[model samples]
Target: MKNLDLFDPRSVMDSDFSLNVSGGDSDFGFAFNDSNFSDRILRIEIMDDAPENRPDSEGCTSIADWARHRKRRREDIKKESVLDLTACPEEQILNCDQPDMEDCGDCGNPDEEAVAMSEESPSGDEAGNSNDSCWSMDSSTVVRVKTLHISSPILAAKSPFFYKLFSNGMRESEQRHVTLRINASEEAALMELLNFMYSNTLSVTAAPALLDVLMAADKFEVASCMRYCSRLLRNMPMTPESALLYLELPSSVLMGDAVQPLTDTAKQYLAARYKDFTKLQEEMMALPLAGVEAVLSSDDLQVPSEDAVYDFVLRWAKAQYPKVEERREILGARLARFIRFPHMSCRKLKKVLTCNDFDHDVSTKLVVEALFFKAEAPHRQRILAAEESATFNRRYIERAYKYRPVKVVEFELPRQQCVVFLDLKREECVNLFPSGRVYSQAFHLGGQGFFLSAHCNMDQQSSFHCFGLFLGMQEKGSVTFAVDYEFAARSKPTEEFVSKYKGNYTFTGGKAVGYRNLFGIPWTSFMAEDSLYFINGVLHLRAELTIRH
Candidate 1:
């Protein structure tokens, strides 16, 4: 019986009160003839027919029926009220029948609004009242009905829905009877929601029950109850099952800001649980669109490169949507934005243009955008990444890739040469502690592709842990090419690129060449703050390669 009053602070501190002084065990603490309430009746009609049993009831009996009923009921009531107003001006009609409450013309006359003893319907014309014609059009449709004496003023104070229904100058507003139609599944939740409107508390604490009440509150436009339910659900133990359920809530519920925190938490949980996409490929593929989006949206996903992410997205899309058109639509619309095109390999980007899964115009635009981003200067690219970070645009954000992105500037004048720049954040370099290797994206020189690799390994000469760098040809078992290459790095005090190694090698396909310990210092000293190497949390290295005649 946890009571959370999110709307009014006073309601939180106030003691709970019962609707009936007699302590009745009814669904709502409803008691007739009590002076503490108003002279109005709330008739909740429950349609208990199962979906398969009722021809008119759609498969979504609970939601579709409840929503259609609410909308149609309001419209019908307003239209009838307007007709009644036109037919009889300057007259307030109170249409109450039944034994517990009496109908009256004058609201101020207590004698006319007297309380009776029996529970029975009026006969003849009174029973065939035109006001109930629309609701009772299909008598068999309504399986059960529950009548309760409710205070319009009290309900209106808590929900705008009731306020508009009761105060909107409608004949139904002036009338003593108000009818609400809902399915049998909504019976308990609707009752809980009504009780909450009166007491600002809920007796149901379980997650599933609270969620049901939350949906009911949303249907009835009770913001406070939704917030209370969201808070209660958030406090309960969350599982992947429950998290996915929260994320998959109806769009109508998600539209409200009150449930946003709950969804955000769900997305975060899914993202963290599946941060390593490589390890959970099958599981991630099995996730629905929302869950996949949650995982891919995170900047923390661990993969080899953006190419792998693109592969996974394609595989998942293909598996989920065997139809080519639907697959293209989903990838182009929902999933494409999560793939960091700017960070993908050039070879992969080329393949993207020919990929049939993406719309031609969309894939072209993305490739052009990625190329433009790659063409920008290093500092300009950093600025763009920083700017896009504010909006959480995943295209510009770099994930933890096993192969880091690099910048390469090619030149034809120096006998076909290229200067490759590899910048590793201080933390990234730190992650290479003891013995770890990180490779850079491939660059082109002399019509051949090459890559830069950084490592932490035991120095062959000193037999101590030291930073290492290497140059490798992307091709394997191919024609050999002789090249002179130089490695340089920016150091403290000067912060200028200082040449470290100068050598020539006849590189065969699949062969690599470089010094084991380029810095010629122990790993600890090279990584120490105020060390000659790192500049402003970045380890900048440059490799210049020139084709030999």
Candidate 2:
């Protein structure tokens, strides 16, 4: 029955699938759909549990069989004896009963005595004890002494190299581990560097040494010390002179190396002192142009025309000026405003004054006119030539304008009147104007009342009027209003007051003040009979006025 079942296609497919038959005599075998023959065989081995019908074993070994074989072989061998172990014990353990005679007789223990003796001995002392007596007479004796001469363990622990270097008296006398020298510099720099090295801090009051210390710290590779020094240097306030010097330093040094050291206050200091630098630069430029020509032409070469002399000096000074902006500013400030007229040669002056607004030409013209009016003939020909030149330039401009036909228009303002009065009633008729062109109005009230009234020309093309309205309210609920009026005339007409109002107004304490006007009417008028009301112990009133242009 089972063989018949195996013949069925479904039963054969479901049976343990195998691609290869090992022990069975079948030459051909069914192939499985999946290619994994080892897994298929493993599944067959798992399902075939019956001893007689189990899958034929081809190349397989049991772990228990191998272990039993190994156990039987191991059991046939003999174990070695460990009772007579040849390992040697330490010398101290071997001589435990023997009294340690390395120390003095009264010493509690040899090790302790040796340690005490080593500590008490001087740095170079080697005769404190001898180990020769304990050793065989024929055996050679070797002595070892280890000495650490560190004075302070804490300092030594920080840096063993430093500790060792100082411990051996290497830093004794003037031959210290670190040496600093300031060459031809102010004492401040030397002091600052010294303070940083010794105490890692600088005196707050030391001015000159502050920056110098920073430079020194950067030179030395002491990171922690340099950080503290940099902080102190950054905090120091610089005077104007120092600030200028600071600005003159190398750009690389200022921007790259020391930029982080700068504080906001220091930056402000530099800004404030910028003018001094500007002046300095100007002076440097001005001096050379002053008298260089005269100096070149002088017989003595030393005493030239004041201009030439000034020019030479300035040129020489400018050549020596630093290239930095701060230095340039100093030079500029000094030279720019300095009076260069006295030292200016006539030729130079002419060249400079050739511009439309030449100072020399103006001054020369004034001098010539003074001479002519005084009946002095100093240089009549020169004076006449300058006068003609001036007249020609003026006429040239005038002709150019005439040919271009550029019109010049003038604007007229409206007439205004302001009036102030004291203790005037709120509804009183303060003043009156006859029927005329009412252009604008404004008012203000404070300690004194202020009012403005403007009248404009009705025939103008376009006109505008502005006014200020200010009102002050008293504790008694009484109010005062003041106004100011301004009128402007223009070519383009704006919308009449009939359409829009053109003014800003603000009201406080429930009181209002503003200009009022109406257009398309016969005339603008203000009446004193306007209504007034009182609410919540506050006075409410309406003041209306009509203005026409």
Candidate 3:
């Protein structure tokens, strides 16, 4: 009886699906190649709007204008994702010459148009009267209706959207014919997606076309197609324009895992290209928010200091957002996190506290946190930097600044003394082997300028390389100053600043003093993996300076 039911022609005739016994000679196999096997017909209604008449059709002369256009287009197309094809009456025709509702002062609200586009109307009058936008079909605005024979099972296997639409027990799911409406710009992309659903390959090769398909795939929830599009785009040669476009994609599309790698590559490209921020100031100043964010977030930015970063951010915010409230909002929310407040100078931090550009509460909190970080001990600061995760706690992580930061504790009661602390990573010391030096920014004590220098020096007696520390006076001429100095380092078993050398020296203009080999050990032994001087891949040094009063 079951076999008889299956063989009944009446059963097959009443069913929405068709079974084809004959095979075809195509690579996609019989089901994909035979039109008789297609279960559903997709009628795509393409609405062609005049480019000159579009509300957003103005020529984009700059990246800012282009960004705004992209945002508006994103908002306009969001409704196309959840289109209700069954709601439209078969006999009704919509005119496309409706006033540009966006420019219309009396048309309820622009968002109401989006709401009307996505929703189903009870009757033609309701759909016609609610908002007659571009999605509607009429003889004047409708370019053409593209009819395609599609297999529901094949499409359902590739996209959850099709699967749900076919199996969700809706009236449209039971119907033999289904309809879709889209702008003429999306017609080629829609056709490409359908072909990909059948053969798992796309015929479009250009980046712009691929991007369209990627967005269409995202709208239709086709993960595989989206990944394919991303891979192809990443393989193509990237330009600044294309890279910014990738970074500025709608958040919904950018958040997908399939497209993340492409966006990351774009970010890295921009970061590398604009690494020397000082040289490219003019070019970078014109960049939109996404491009600026990409450039600023890099750890390898070659700026003089975080002070420069703060100034650039302020300038950018002012140029982009002239309004004070909007500028403050952007600075507080989007750009402030990348400034590395803890690494900025005390002077800049003070300016931050008094600046009216930032919210009072936010500036106060940032300044307080920076001050606390500055007060932390060298080891405590290292711990904070090491423990911070990549996402939320990057404030403690230092960038490659021209002038390395130092912690100084001054004492007025103890005859004008200052204890300066400097920490270097093992790799930084390793890079200085044979003959190299690293300098700290100048510190002042008793109206005298001084700096600490670490070098790999040759011990004349032993004729071998060893690590050295020196204290130098920046002033020149006949002025002579006397000072008591001491150099210490943290070692294994007890990571405390143990005194390595101490001496009293009278300094003249352009003069320096210190032991040639501070550790009294060869470079190889001092830099050995089991060396006692290194604590957790970091070399901590402290210098105490006291005036001989």
Give the candidate number with the greatest lDDT. 3
Error of 3 at 492 (Å): 4.1
Cα deviation of 301, candidate 1, in Å: 0.6
- For model 2, residues 363-461, the per-residue Cα lDDT tens digits are 465334433432422133235434745551211111100001111111223422222211112222222122232111123223322222322212122
User: Which residue window of length 10 is worst by lDDT in model 3?
Assistant: 18-27
Per the 3 Å backbone cut-off, how many clashing residue pairs does candidate 2 have? Answer: 39
Q: How close to the true structure is residue 487 of candidate 1, measured as C-alpha lDDT?
A: 99
Cα lDDT tens digits, model 1, 95-160, are 323233344332223323434322333344633353443233334345555666565655665565
TM-score of 2: 0.21
Clashing pairs in 3: none
lDDT of 2 at 362: 48
What's each prediction's clash count? Answer: 0, 39, 0
Q: Could you give candidate 3's per-residue lDDT for residues 1-549 as a string of tens digits? A: 112112222233234432221111112433342335454445555655445323232355443454455565765565452443234323212222223323445323422221111222234453345234324434324456665555666666566566656655544455545556667666677778877776667887766667778877887777778888899989988778878988866535433887888899999999999998778788999988989988888888888778888999999999999999999999999988888899887658889999999999989999999989999876788789878855655788887776667777889984999999888889989988889988776777888888888999899696799999999999999879999999999886476679999999999988999888999989999998899888878899999999997
RMSD of each: 8.2, 39.2, 10.0
In candidate 1, what residue range of length 10 has the lowest lDDT sum? 1-10
Report lDDT (Cα) of residue 355, candidate 2.
30
